[model samples]
Each structure stands twice: as structure tokens, then as C-alpha cells.
Target chain A: MSGDIVIEAKGLTKTYGQAVAVDHISFTVGRGEIFGLLGPNGAGKTTTILMLLGLTDISGGQVSVLGFNPAREPLSVKRRVGYLPDTVGFYDQLTAADNLRYTARLIGFRLAEREKRIGEALDRVGLSEFAEHRVGTFSRGMRQRLGLAEILMKGAQIAILDEPTSGLDPHATAELLTIIRRFKTEGVSVLLSSHLLERVQSVCDRVALFSAGRIALMGSVSDLGREVLGSGYVVDIEAEGSGLGERLALVPGVNRVEQTGIGKLRLHADRDVRPEAAAEVVAQHGRLKFLGVQEPSLEAIYTHYFAARPDGTLKEGARHAA
Target chain B: MRREGSAFNGLGVVMLKELADHLTSIRFIILEIIVMLIAVGTVYVATQQIKDTVAQDPFLFLKFFTTSRAPLPSFIFWLSLLVPVMAIGLAFDSVNGEYNRRTLSRILSQPIYRDALLFGKFLAGLMTLAIALLVLWLLVIGLGLLFIGIPPGGEEVARAFVFLLVTLIYAGVWLALGLLFSIVFRSAATAALATLGLWLFFYVIWPVLAGEISQIIVPPDPRYMALGLQTPGTVVLEQFLARLSPSTLFGEIVVAILDPTTRALGPIYLSQLQGAVLGAPLPLGASVLIAWPQIVGLIATSIILFVIGYVVFQRQEVRA
Candidate 1:
């Protein structure tokens, strides 16, 4: 990305009475980037989205979307943005096509173009077959897909989806993720929130982890893993010999060593210890059966971040990970 | 260029959608059927009685609305009793129903202003009520012409037209009340029950309460008992208290417009009536002039209630 900012928030703070929902948070989303807001429930993720859309009044701070101040020019901003709320709602009596038609009309689509756009949107979300069915009869996954179809019909330049895969089966979730990926190809910026770290790790180009109404960690999945878990790699070695743990521990960069089986050793090192550990085992006259490097997963990084401190504050080293 | 008033960008769409829904809903259809049956049935009975009296009555067409048969009431009375029920039914869920369905936030998130949603709902309800009243008015007029075999004069038509307008204004008051309750309450059932409760209180219990309050405030003097005349102060106080209810105001306007012989709604001096003919019908303009205060009261009440709903709805958060 060329750093062409599409959304910017500076000192964005929201307080409902004495409780601070969002406090002095700032972030920017680049054009055509899929930015994931990863947070547990009540971490202020939904509040931040509402503030960006101007659906709720800001207690204090500034936000701009598409170069228009959302607080002052909400209609102009809203016209260019699409929002799928956490609990997407539709008129139960109306069919899927009718619901999309209502939204198209509200967005000021003319009659001639509305029908074509609705068709294209429904087809994109894989809901073309159920277009004539009332939404009340739809499953949770179908309704979520219908919401995506509505956003598509609007042709919104910016799409903000909250908990998009919530209440969906594994297959439905995979289908939704694929559709979300297409938004980037079309050059539409997407900001989606989810509590499922695995889902976010799979699709997000960059993510901000929210904890206690603050961004505790933010970066690409690999960068976050390295920052929170330390600059290290695990090398697993299987050798049909004795004394391999002592031999691997003598390697200069190896941090720790563990035995898996009678002839297995797991080496934690800050650098690529695979070559050194393999050569050392061979030198010891041991038959090296298997040797592999294990990179830290996002789940480990998340657990490390939370388990690292009691105050829910990010460690100093992880602050600059973004 | 974009429209000058973008705040109301989606107003027409919302209004048209709501109006279509109201017209097609089962609740509105059932209410329309019941109201029409009662109105037509009473007018039919009144027509039978008026047939024998038409030879002597000059304003026989106006009698279609004001004349009563032995067991049934007049056409205007049935309208006065049923129009509020229809108006309340149409709007009691206008705002809260959207919340219950979880569509309020989604709709507000569109490019439209919050004002547009409430305004469109109120306007749509008023339009539906107006259309129903127009149809009922035409049906009665058509039946009158068929039974009496005489076309109404221009003056009679003008008077009836003004009466129809006044009736619509009266219905607007209740529609506004229903909308206000809808905005104040979160549940559709609670808003509906609250509106209906207010309606019943005003329609059935208010007159008796107003009379009792007036008697306590301005007691009748024993000095005038032998003359068998009501005290002017007590009567005025009672009428003023009763006018607080929209139904009372509507009833007064109906009487003045439909019954042209009604010289005044308040006290009339003996000197003012000396040269006036006893049975002469007032001109359409004069009747409207006499009931002008009542008409203004109905309109002012509707506007007041609408403003309250607008303010409350604007301040509300769209989270729910």
C-alpha cells in the first residue's frame, strides 16, 4: 500500500457519563487494505465503528472519512460508506430482494440502475437463489450474507462490518471470508471486527488487538508473533542417539532445550538454529531422523500478550510492533 | 448537483413505503371494514326515516349527516366515535415498531436525517386517515343522492366539504397522540395500550369529569332557581373545561358545520336573535366562522403533539 489514507482518527474519545468507552485512540487505514479490529466483547470496537460512521455522537475527538468530517458531514460520509451492524436487522415481512431495494432507494439509486445492482449484489453473496424468500425464514448465515449483498448494492467505497462471521457455521464463515477478500481486489477499503483470532489472522493484512478500550498490540500476524514471543525459532530434532540435548544446548544462540521422546530434542533459539543443530547432531555420530523449524502462531502471541502483564498494558517492546 | 435539502433526501421513499404498508396491513383493513359497515348501516337507516320527512325539509341533503333514526345514531355521530379509533390504530406502532423489528438503526444509518423518518411516518398516517375519510364521505353522499333522488345544492356541498376537512383535522390530533406515545415507549404493545387508554379517558370519562369540576368551581346560584334558567358562569365554565378534550372540540365543529341551523356554539343574546329567522340555515362561510376556534384547537393540538414526538425522537440513541 502507498499509505494513501482513507480513514483517520485522532484522539478519538467517547464517554458515556463517567465511563470511558473509547479513550484517546488513534489509527489510520490505508486505501485497499483489510484492517481487522480484533477485540473481545465490550472492548470498544463497536463504539469506535459507530463513531466513525457518525451514528453516535462523539464525546470528544476528531474523525474524518473520505476527507469529510463525519460529525459535521455525516450524510456525505454515510453516502460513501456501508455499515453492517453487529446484529444485522431486516424487515421480516419483506423478501431479500425487497430489503435490498429499500436500501438502494434510501441511497438514492434510480429505478433503472437499482434492479441491475440488486441482482449483481445478491449473486456476489451467493444469495441469488433465495432472493424471493422472506428474510424471517432465513438462517443466521443467510442473513449475514444478505447484509453483505446490501453493502454491495450500495457500491460503498468504504465497508465497515462488525462481527461479520458471528453466528455462522464453519462453511458459512469460509464463504464470507472469501467474499471479504474480493473487496480488496475491487479497491474498496474494509474495516472488520472479530473476536476470533484465527479468523482475523487468516484474512487481515494488518490488525490492532484491543484490550480494556485500548490498542494493546497491532501489526501483521508474523510481526506480532515475533514481537510478543521474542525474536526466536523452535527447531525440533529427532536423532537415534544419546546426549543430543547437551549437544544442542551448547549451540551459541540456543535459549533452551527439551526432550520429546527417548531420542528427540526441541531447541528454542533466537536465530535459525536448524543448520547448527543438524551439524552438531551429525558430528556426534547420531542418525538425524527429522529436523524442522516451528514459527510461533498468532494464538501464542495473543496468549503471551495477555499473560505477560496484570494491568492489561502492552509491554514496552511490543508498542512499536506496528 | 446534489439536492439542496439533503436532510429530507429519503423522505418521499419512507413515506411511500409506510403508506403502502399501512394500506395493505390486516389491522388497517379490518378497521376500515368495520367502520364502513357501521357508517353505511346507520346512514341507510337514517335515509329510510328521512324519506318521509324530505317533502318538508329544504336542507334534506345536510340531514343525511345530522338526522338520526329510532335505534341508530346520526352519520356524523358514528364518525365522531370511530375516526379516532382508526387514527390511533394506524399510528400506535409507527416508531416503536421499527425498534422492535430492529430496523431503526439500519434505517437511520442511511444518508437520511432522523427528522425524515418521524416526519414521513406522521405524514403517511395522516394521509391514510384522510383517504379513508374521503371514501366514507363519498359513499354516504352517493347513498343520499340515490335515496332522496335529488342532487345537493352548491351551498350544501360546500358545507359538507368543509365538514370533511374538519373531520380530518380531528383525526390528525389522535394520530399525533399515537405517534407521541410510540416515541416515548420502547415496546409497541405498551405504546398502543397507552394511546388507547388516553383515547378512552378522553372519549368516555372526560365529559363527566369536566362537568363535575365545573359544578365545583362555579356553583349554581339558588336565587335564580324559580326562573328555571342555568347560570351563565357555570355553563361557560363547563363548556371551557370540556373543550380541553379533542373529541369535544371535534363534536362542536361537526354540529356547527353539519347542522346549519346552529346559530352559535356559545351563549347567544336575545337582541342578536330578534331579527334572525328561526329555521334558516346559515351560510357555509358563517358556519365555518362560528366553529373557527374549534378547528384551530384541533390543528394546534396536533402540531403540539407532533413537535413533542419530533424532539424526543431526535434526542434518542439508535442503539436499540
Candidate 2:
């Protein structure tokens, strides 16, 4: 709800040997917002996340988490930041309660405080009943919940999760989104990076689109949709004659056109030109069986921005295109 | 900010948790079972041998007991040799496994320092080795009493106690070595392999190979070689090659415990030791005094290795 920044990075870069994994990228997440870092695989999203948590070295640039420099003040910064790695990798031999208890103790929680926190966190993540079970025997979703339980036990002000819902089922993913939503309501700023755009869009208030090592486009979901397409509609049409409306719909900036039947067509075109196109279709071809406008999904917008780069890198040029 | 005392509390927490981890770990369980089996098998075989030997010639006991001052039941000798191997096995994966499991990052993220992590692991390892050693010692003493019917003299007790101290310190060296290897090598399997390789090299392979090298380096003259070659060659060659091994340093300590008449040569007079077979097998006090440097060297080596590990761990990157 507030515009206050929880994490801020400027010209952040990380390079391993000859390859630059995360180029000089910059972004900020506001307080209490679920900020998603959306990118395809090998896009440096995880690298950027690590840099924010002070887990990885910063080859160049500066980063501050909760107003403390992550490099110089890692302990202080880490005190208020909880990180969930890609795979979770809990101590498989330890019971969930034991694992959480161990982590809680490490973060300097009082024994009494940790006891309560452990119980509450496990309950919140819906693993309360399975707290006594070894993590090795837990299902993937249960392990994820335990990982969340560990993070929540720390009582961190910010949560940085890398691909938290990657392997979860639809039900588990929904449960995870609910937990993240609850954290957001409690004023915990979350930085979630995943290749799942729909999941990110559902949980996040804002998103930073990453490609290669750079952030290509960053803004609210609606704002990015508006900026990229300026109100585009995906129109599906059914005609009687030669599907000529679908062929003529291939003007510059017109995204795509597909024939659904002998005369039916699906049109992805600019909003301002849709009425003009439809009018021409009526005059030139025939009567239309159906014509409607639908909002552009995040998938369509993501493709429109990412597909331009031959290498699929979302750098400055692709950012401008978006 | 929270108080500073909590940081140490965090360390205590890790220590306790690791202790539990060790208790429940299959590695520790399997090691305990193996060590107990070896100790029981060894003591049983030794008891049977001593009984049969005494029956053959009752006076043989007098010769065995009086000729060498090394306080026996000879169980001490076997115990010393076996303890280090067991200790190394228990600790070889302490740090390396954490790296492999990727749990080090999660654990270190807590308010504890790298030093505390190493210290906690080392302490836990020492405790485990001590416990195992304790069980073996008790069993050895009990078996000795059953067969020999001697409760052991004050000198015997003193020597056994000193031997235990040496065993603990020796085990510390291995624990430290394993930890250092873990830190240097990221993979647990690689660290385990490297540690076993080093153990084999130092304990078995090195001594044999060094003996062969010594023979080639200082071969016997044909005129003097045949009649008394084994005696003079063994004396000169062992002294020279033993100096190359920490195990040799330990072997000297063991010899001094059993035979307390040999006098220890000082550092300045180490050269004088070339042709001289140690006279008046050194007193236990004198052996410890002379071997203090070697003992300290092993301990210091351990400390230095762990310190390097700590530094590497502190600088490593932990991903989210």
C-alpha cells in the first residue's frame, strides 16, 4: 500500500568466469507488495535474488535491503530478511518441528519464543499435523510448506523466495498463494521470482520482467498491459466466405491471426484498429457471426516482449519495445 | 537490537542440534556398531592368546611382563592404533556433508559465526570419539582383570590415563584434518576419499614405502649386511623414516609408555641419535616432555586447517 522501498538495487551485476549472469540491473520493491521477478530459465532472476539477500557476491553496483547495505550489513539485513532457496532442501533426516526449531535457534530466537513461533508457523503453512514426520518422507508440497514454516519462524520483515511454487500442484500452488497473500497483508514485503507468469501475476502487485541478466519491463500488471498494447483486444470472428478478414488483419503491429473454421477467425490487433478492421470485414467479406474484445493475458504480453530478441534476452531494446 | 549473549546461545543451539543429529545419524550408528565389534573381537582374541601363552609356559608371563616396561595387557597398543582410524571415519563428512546437503547456508544464516560452527562440530566429534574410546578402555580393563587377576598398579593406572589423553589429542588431529578437508573440498565424497587416502598413506602405505626408500638410500655394505643386517639396518632406517611421520611421533610415545627406561634425546642432540639405540628406555615424564613438540605440532596443524576452513566458509556465497 505504501510507496516506501523495501529493497533497492542499482546497476547490480554478477559474473561467473566469462559469462555475465546478471548484468547491471536495477529495481525496487515497495513495502507490503508482492513483487515478482518474471523471466524464463537462465534469465539471472535467481542470481539477482541471491544478491539481494547478500548470499552471493556483487560483481558491481550497490544493493540495500530494508535500508541496510546488504554487503556491509548482512547480519542486520538478514535479521529481517528470510530466504527460501529454489529446492527448499530441508534437513531431510530431521523432523519438521526439529528443523524449524534448529533454524529458529540459529536466528537467535529465544527458546520460549521459538517454541511458540515453530508451532504457529507450521500451523500457518498447514503442516501442523505432520510436524513430527521426517522431511524426507514429506510430499513435495509438504516440503514447500515446511520451508515456508522455517522462513515464517524467523519472523522476517521481508521474504525472498526463488521459484517457490515451481513444482507444486494447482491446489498446493493456490495454498501457497494464499500464504503469500496473508504475508502481504501482515506488511511483509515479498520478492518472488518464477517462470510462472500467471502465478506471479496472481500473487504480485507489481512485476519486474527479466530476460538474460537485465530487467526488460517493470510496473504493475495492468500498467504494463496498457503500456505495451495500449488496450488491445483478442477478437474471434466467424464469417461465411473466404476468411479474408483474418488475412487483412495482418497489418503492421497486428500481433497474430488464426483461422478457427472455414470462416471463423481469431484476431490479435490494436484496440483502436479493431473497429476499423471489423467495419472493413463487414463491408468487404460478409456478416459476422461473432465479434468480441478480451483482455490480453500476461502470457501474450510476455511473448510480445520476449520473442523480439533472437537470443531471448530482455535488455534495454526489448524493454523499449514492451 | 537483541543482546550479545544470544549469539553464544545460538552456538549452544547448533551444538545441541548437531549432537542430536549425530545421535540419530546412520553414519554415527554404523560407526558405533563397527567400533564395538572390532573392540570386542580384538579383546576376545587377545584374552584367548594370553591364556594359551601362559598355559604353554607359566614363566613366559614373567618374561612378557618384566622384559618390556610397556604397561600391557598389550590391549593399549591395539587400542591406540585403532582409535585414530575410527575417529577419522566419524568426522570425515562433518563439514563436507553439510556442504553437499546445502544445509551450511541455512545453518550459517542464523546469528552464529563460522568459528562457532567449526568449534561445535569439533567438540561434538571429540565427544563421540571419547565416548567410543571410553567404552573400549573399560572393556579392555575388565578383560585384563578377568584373565590376569591383577587390578593394575598406580603406575599402570597413570600410564593408561596418559594414554587416554594422548588418544583424545590424536583424535582431535584427525577431526581437524577431516574438517579442513571438508572445507577445502566442496563434495562430501571427495573429502571422504581424500581423508581415507591420507589415512592410508600415513598409517600404512607411507611407512612401508618409506622403509623401502630408506633401504635404497642407505643400503647395507655386503661385508656388514648378512649377519647383523636386520638389527643395525632396522635401527638406523626406522629412526630416520619415523621422523617423517606423526604416527612415528605417536609410536615413540607408545614405546615410552610401555618401556620407561629409554632417555629422550633433546632437540640440539637429535643428531647424536643417529647410531645410538635409545638407552634407558625414556621415563614416562621424559617421553612426554620430549614429545610435547610433536603433540603440539599435530594440535596446531589441526587448528590451522580448521581456521582455513572457517575463512573459506565465511567468504562463500549462499543462494536464495
Candidate 3:
């Protein structure tokens, strides 16, 4: 909302007869921002992405990509925004380069420009050595890289990736996240949907948690954690001390202090109370052994937000939707 | 709502890419071998027999396609079946193969309409069929010139060219049928089976069914049959029902185009034939005139099939 909005959905909805797949969800993706759509498998993330790309019809409401109506001016929207579908596949019989060549032709790039762009894209993804290999022989991670390379080759202003790291190993997921971060650095808006919240948390700047065809929560990780978990900061105090818990409770911004074990305490605060708590611990003649603050992860935020509602109704709803 | 840009923007690229794939595929190579045997092998044997027993025949060169030795039907007989087989073989997997490969969604997500992909595939299949047919036609012509020393007349060339063109249209009909089934069914094997099943129904089953249906419709007039003359309208109804199959329509067209003496495609009354000279070959134009309705039927059927495919593809979801 602060910067140029690349994707703006106004109550975008999709239905199959009586069942609604995406139920009037609205969100805006700012330029050069990594926006994550995090939820379980049937949370309508992929459906939302498809509606934004105009690959599927919006049964109600509307969406726009780069200021062009996706339902009406789909070609213009598709021209500037590259989409990497979930479990993306290519012609297995064709070589990697030949596959890219076919896409380049579809993008209407001339011969000379196509080859050069393909070379650069493949090299950028570190797939230059495998350009001549048949796509049937590509590993899962390599295929994802190639999908990303396609978005890069398109020179798109926005990239929509669905489940980019679903089947990848930890090392591969790390590498993929690096390339995604590079997209943000290069000023390309990234709108990615995934169920793997923990792995993708490091890359996404803002995220929407979906459940049963609706967004349950939408904001940055820490903001949602604060609103849901009552306090966003969790600081650990490891020191040789006495009466530190009672003393640390009076520190500014520190909400409360608990004695975990002998001479150890955990502090929940509205903000970073590590500095104030440390000062207070030392003021009581305690020798500080160690101190650290845990970064709020999306996984904790997602589970805590959903679990806070009594009766486990949303979880049951999510399971039925799946 | 109006979608932006031309639907035909990437039509040529998809057409060329698919064309290249078809021509280089192993399936096409097998088809090409069968075609060589059917076109060249059949024509060569027929030429040997035609040369040995030649009388004062005016349209002798046209006989290259019509003449048959024992144990082999005329080239026209095999061709009516071969053209459809080749066309179906080329197109049965055209749409569903993309779905199975998971490439259809990716291509559709590009800056092109669904029309370009479907139309390009149909065009590419037609072009590939044309190329194979052209090569087969040339080989048969070469065999004719090699075996039969005398050169064919100008009218003979015109008539043979017309047969080639009709065969292409005939190929288009089956290609469209296969294309339609490819879109209707999501699996390539299922689409192939469905198209082949329909082809078989038309090729073998319908002709017999047509006769039975026509008999039920007109009831084979016993009063007229007592005089040893066939009943009127009965034969017409049978032919009409039979020609519903594109195979029958194509066969009739080939008969009129290749055999100049084919005076009619349907039943003819003795009174209607009384004024015509016996054993006289009609001009190429007259023969075409006789086959005009069947030719138009073949063309219309192909167009209808292709339009159905286009509509279904447009409404389909891009994801597999």
C-alpha cells in the first residue's frame, strides 16, 4: 500500500457451482515485496493465484495485475507477470534449452534475443551446464530452478510462484529462497503460496494465513504474533543470580518474568527488553552468563493464531476443505 | 469481457513447433513406412498388371490408382482407409498429450489466447498430414512414369491432382475428429481408443446399419420388386444414411475423382441412365460436379469437429 501496488484483489472470489474455492479475499502486493500465501493444502492459495493470472475465471468480484484487469486485459497482465505453476512440468522429450526456446517463441522474442536471454537465465540459475540435457532427466530441484529461470527470462515486474519448495530438500529449499530473495533485491514483486511455513518464513516480508477459503490472519510475522500471542518478544536470561526474576519484572517494556529453573528466567515483553533486563540483572550484582532473543517464526505464529480459538473448529474446517 | 491482444499472436510458433515434433516422431515414421507400402507398393503392382493388359482405353493413366490385381484391392480402396488412419494417428494425442505432459498450462500462461494453441495444433497436424500425403502422391506418380512408358495426358494430371486435393480434405476430416476427441478426453490412450472406435463404427458398422435402417424406413417395396426393378427412394435413403460417415463421403469423392466413368454417387434409375452413352468417361468438371455434395460434406464435417474442439479448449481450465 505504501509503494506501487502490483497486484490488487478486491474481494476476489471463485466458485464451482455451490462450493466456493476463494471466498471474497482481498490483498495487495506491493512492488519489490515478498508476499507469502501460507496455509494448508486446501486453503485456496493456488486458486487465488490462478485468478490473479486469469488462468481461472473469478466467479465473483475482480482482481488486477499491474493495473490491468486480469479478467478483461489478461494478455497484458500475463505479458508482464510470470507465473510458475505448482508442480510445473515441461516437455520431457525436448532438451532444456529447446524447452526454453519454445517458451521464448511463445513470448514473441526474436531468435537472437531468445538464445541470449535463455543463456543468461539458465546461467543465472546455475543450470547452464544442463542446457543440452533432456528435461526428463532433470531433478526436482533443477526443475524448480528452471521454472524460476523462466520468470527471470521474462523480465517480469512480478513473479507468482505456487509451492516453490514443497518437494525440495533443506539444502535445495535454502538455495531456492536465496534466488527468491534476489528477486526482491532486483525490484521484482514476489507473490508465492506455500504450505511449508517454516522454510519460507525467512524469505517472505508479509504473509497471509488462509484457512477454509478465507484469510484468517494477514500481516508481518511479528505483528500477528503480538496480536495473537499477547506478547511478541521472548527473551532468555542465563545468569548467576538471585532474585533476578523479581527485579527484571520492573524493567521497562518487560511484561513479566518467570523463573524457569535454578537461577534461569524467561521474560515475555512488548518489545526488545534484552537491554533493559540485562541492565537490571547486573544492577542486582548478578553475573550475566548468556542472553538471547528468539526471532518470531511464521510456524509459531500460524499454529498459535489457529489454536487460540476454542473447540478447534477452524482446524476441523481446514481438514474438511482439504 | 474482452481479453487483450490478438489470439493469433503465437499461432505460427506453436504450429511450427508441433509440426516439427510430428514429423520427427517415431509414430509418424511408422506411419510413413505403412504409407510407402500402401501408396507405392500398391501402385507399383497395379502398374505392372495395367501395362500387361492395355486396350484402347482413354483414361488409362487414371487407372493407375483404380486398377487392382488379385489379392490386393485398388489403391483407391486402401487409400480411403489409409488417409483417415494417418490423420487420426497424427492427431489423437495432440491435445491430451500436452495435458499429460503438464505443458499445456505453462504454454497457456504465456501471453497468448487458448485459440492459438488449439488452432496451431490443428493446423500443424493438417500440415504434417499434407506433407506425408504429398510425398506419397509423388512416389506413386514416379512409379507410374517408370512402369508405364507412355506419358499421361493433361486431363489425367488434372484428375490425379484433384484426387490428391480430395484426399487432403479427407485427411482433414479425420484429423479434426481425432483433435475433437483429444480435447474431450483427458488421457491420450482414451482419446485414441474413442476416435478409433468412432472410426470403426463409421468405417465398417455404419454401412450395414444404414442398409437395415433404410429398409425399415422404406420397407423394400415388394410390388415394385415383383417387376424386377428396385423400389424408388429406398436406395436414396440408404445412401443418404451411409454418407453420414465421413469415410463413406470420402470414398464417394475418391470414386468420382479417380474414376471418370463414375456417373453418380447414389442409386440411379434405368430411365436416368438411358440417355447417357455407355462406357464413356465424363469430363473432369462433370465428375467433380457429381462429387460436389460429398466433398462439401467432408469439408463441413471437419470444420464442425474443429470448432467443437476450439470451444471445449477455450472453456477448459489451464491446470491439468
Candidate 4:
């Protein structure tokens, strides 16, 4: 409903026969944000994306993209959003230029501007050299780049990329992420879905960890660390004397106090409480050594949320952060 | 916020792409060659028949071009058999092949509706068949002038043109059948095989099987067989069942074109031709109009098949 909201879905659900794909879930992506939907395979990420694109019928709820209902107003939503599906295929016999030209014409671009726009799009994706070659002969990375080029040609306010860097090498992945970042700087909102946590962590400002057909956690990277992992800190200390473990556990908001080996305590405490716990430890045991606190990584949070799944099988609403 | 006819626009865009692909593809080239082969082969076979008839009786020249028989050597007869096969082969894989190649989803993503793809392909296939038919007719007329030493009369040319139109409709019937098969079958090869199987059933197997049933039902009353003894061709027991086949309808259209005195079948040839003159051209317009139902049936069948394909395509999900 707001200008900043690029995508809004409320109670969206899809079922094929008896199997529920995406079930009663809601989320929103604000403008100029790299929002990732993190889920493993068959977690309904693709189904949710398809429903948002108006390509699949939804059994329940509603979806609005760019302030238009994708089901009833797909054309409008499609016009404002560029989508790079997991894989993009082209007319195998046609040259890349011809393919792009055809796509341009289909989308109602004027013939006069087609050549120029296609050239610019290819250049943007670093695929200008392969413009005249048949797309069938293209490598996997080249096809991915071309798919990005097609999306760029849409000139959309929002981009929905479903695993954009799925099959790419490290170099290609970095290239695609850089292009996505450039779009972000240009004020385009991005909704990317991927199982690759590292890729999502690097490119996204915020992420939704999907599990059991819902967002288990959703928020910005740092917000998640500070809020969920308590300022991203963990303390592991080696006690020098008796009763050090019990003394550390007595601290307020100390989550866990574990004894590792002879006179060692690994303390899991909130970041704010860590300083106090350490102060108390130093006061009581002067011979204490190996006292340190490590910041929690995105990987750690991802695993924590994934491990907390009640059914032990991650669902679509598995995104967790913030 | 602004959703104005993007699906319609997508359809148009997709149609243009599909038409271009069809026109330039190897499949079209191969189909064209196959059609040419059929036309040439028919012409060659007919020339041999004409030469043998002429050699048997030099005085039968007047009856050669005009006859009231059920089957004759007119251009229409040859067209009836060849055109349907051509149409079937050209279109059988049109839609299913795209699905098989995983190109339908990709193509659909480009601002086009499903209707455009089906309609565009249908129009293109018809156009291709029209071109082939026109060339074949020209070749036939050219050969007739070269070998017969007589330029065709106005009525002859009119009849020939009407026959060409009939052939076009016959081809349309097959195109519709092919499109239907394409929609029903997922693989292009399977679609093609299904169309061929249908063709074989209607053209060859069904009629023969029906003959046995009809004979058993009506026990070949000696009276009926005796009455038909004077008929030029053998009246098989399956004659009634055979009439339901498309091949039969097409054959009737051909006979109507060649036979001037072909009136209501109940009357004997002697009475039917009582008022008709020898070597006169029949009213071609009246004959086509008489067979209008069959022509319309073929056209309607084609449209229905295409509509089914269109609906199926639009409803299908496009995966990456």
C-alpha cells in the first residue's frame, strides 16, 4: 500500500492436489533493499515467486507487486518488475540480438528504440560480444548474463531473481552480485531467492529465513545479529579454580554455561551481559585465561533457525532474522 | 497500477516470433519438399493412367476429360488424397514440439497471449499449404496444356480452381487434427504418431473393419447386390460405413468435380443423363455448394481443434 513497498503478499497459499506448496504466508519488500528468501529445495520459494508473477494460480490469499494484484493485474505488475527465473531459455536458432529484438517488440517497445535499448542492455550485463551468436551455443554463465540483460531491458522498479547465481562459477557469481548491487544503488528493490547462504549474506541487506512454509526470521543482517545473537558476541573462558562455572551461570540473562575440559567454561550470554560476566570472572579467578568473545556469523544464525524446525523439515516461511 | 492488455500484447508478440520461426525453420523446408513430392508423384501416376486409357481406345478421348463415374482422372481426385496427408504432417507437431523443446514457457514470457501462438501457427500453416497448392495447380495445368494440345475452357479453369479450394479445406481438416493431437500429446513425436494413427484408422483400417459389420448386419440381400451389378464399381458391404470417413467425403468432392451427370444416386445412369449432353462441363458452383456441409465440417473441425490447443497452452504453467 505504501510507495516504499515493492512486493506485498498476505496469507498466500498454493496447493497442488493434496500437497501444500506455499501455505498461508505474508511478507513485504521495501524499495531499494536486497531482500533474500533463504530456503532449501522444495521449500516453496519457487512456488511463491511463481504466484507473485501470476504464472501459477493461488489457492488462497492475495499478492500485490508494485501496488497491483499479480493475479488480476499481472500485466501491470510484470511491467514494473524484472524477473530472472532460475533458468532462462531462448530461441535456439536465433542470434542473441534477434532474440532480444523479438522480446523488445513483444513488450511493446518502439522499433526505433529497440536496437539501442537491446545494445545498452547487453552492454549492462557484459554480453555485448555475444549479441550476434545463437543463444543455444552460449555457455551456462553466458546464458545467466543474458537473462540478467533481459531483466535490465524491462527497466523495472523491482527485480525478482529466483536463484540468479545458481550455476555460476565464483567469478560469474561475483559479476552478477555486482550488477544486482548497481541496481540497488539505482533505487530498484530486489527480491532474490536462494539456498546459498553465503551469496545471500553478501548481497542482501536483509533476508527472510524460510522454514515450514513461513518466515521463521526476517530482518537486516546486523539487526539480526544484534537482536537475535545479542550483539553478535559469544564468550568462551577457561576457569582457573573451583566454582567458576556456577559463578558465571549466576549472571543475569546468561543463556548457558557449559564445562568443556578441566576447569573450562563456555558461556553463552547476551552481548551486553558478556562484559559483566567477564568482569565477575576476572574478579573471582585471577588465573583465568583464554577469555574471548566471538561475533556470530550469518551462517550461525541460519543453522540455529534451521535446527529449530519443529517438523525437522524446513517449510516455506523459514526466513528468520531481525 | 496500469494493467492494460499485456496478455493480448504478449500474444501478438509471440505470434510474430512463432510465424518467423515457422517460415525460416527446417521443418517448413522439409514439409514443402514432401508436398512437392506428393504433387509430382500424383501427376506422374495420373499421366500413366491417362496414357493407358488413351492407348486402349483412341475413340474414348471425348469421355476422358468428362465422366459421370464415381472415380475419375480429374485434378480434384488426386488433390483429395494428397492434400490431407500434407496438412497432417505440416501441423501434427506444431505445438507439442515447442513444449518438448522447453521453448513454450520461454516464448510465453515475452509479452504475448496464448491465443496468438495458436492462431498464428494455424494461419501460417494454412498459408504454406495455399502456396504449395497454387504451385501444384499451375504445374498440373501446364502439363495438361502441353500433353493434351487443348487450352482449358473457362468452365474447366473454374472447376480446377474450385477443386483447389476443396483441397485447401481438406488440408485445413488435417491441420486441425494435427493441432488437436499436439495438444493432447506432450511429445512432438507422440503427437505426430497419434495423428498418423488417426489418419490410418479413418483412411484405411476403419472402412475395412466396418465392411464386415455391415455385411453381417444386412446379409448382402441378393436383391441389393443385383441392382448394383450395373454400377461401375463394386458395392462393398461397408459402403454405408465407409461414407463416414473424411477420405470418403473428399472422394465424393472429387467425383462431383469430374462427373458432369452425377445426379441423385437412386436413379440409373441412363435416366440421370437423359437430358445431359456428352462432353459438357457440370455446374461446378452448384456441385461445391452441394458439398458445402463437408467443407464446413472440415473447417469447423479445424477451428475446434485449434481452440482446444490454445486453451491448453494458456492454462499450462511455464517453468524455467
* Stretches of candidate 3 exceeding 4 Å from the true structure: A241-243, A259-264, A281-289, A310-322
Question: Pairs clashing in candidate 1?
Answer: none
How do the predictions measure up, each by TM-score?
0.90, 0.80, 0.96, 0.80
lDDT of 2 at A311: 58
Query: A129-169, model 1: which lDDT tens digit per residue?
Result: 99999999998888888988988998988899999998888
* Candidates sorted on lDDT, descending: 3, 1, 2, 4
lDDT at residue A25 of model 4 (Cα atoms): 86
Question: Which pairs clash in the backbone of model 3?
Answer: none
lDDT of 4 by residue, A50-167 (tens): 8988777889998888778877776676667777777666677888888788778767799878888899999998989889999889977888788778778868788888888888
How far residue B299's Cα lies from its native spot in candidate 1, in Å, is: 1.5
Q: Worst 10-residue stretch by lDDT in candidate 3 chain A?
A: A310-319
Instruction: Report the lDDT of model 4 for residue A278.
Output: 67
| lDDT of candidate 4 over B229-318, digit per residue (tens) | 522233444665676677766676655664544543222467656876765544767767656666676667667767777777777766
- Would you list the rank order by DockQ, best first? 3, 1, 4, 2
Best by DockQ: 3
Write model 3 residue lDDT over A134-201, tens digit each, in one string: 99999999999999999988889999999999899988888899999999988999999999988888
- Evaluated at residue A243, the lDDT of candidate 1 is 79
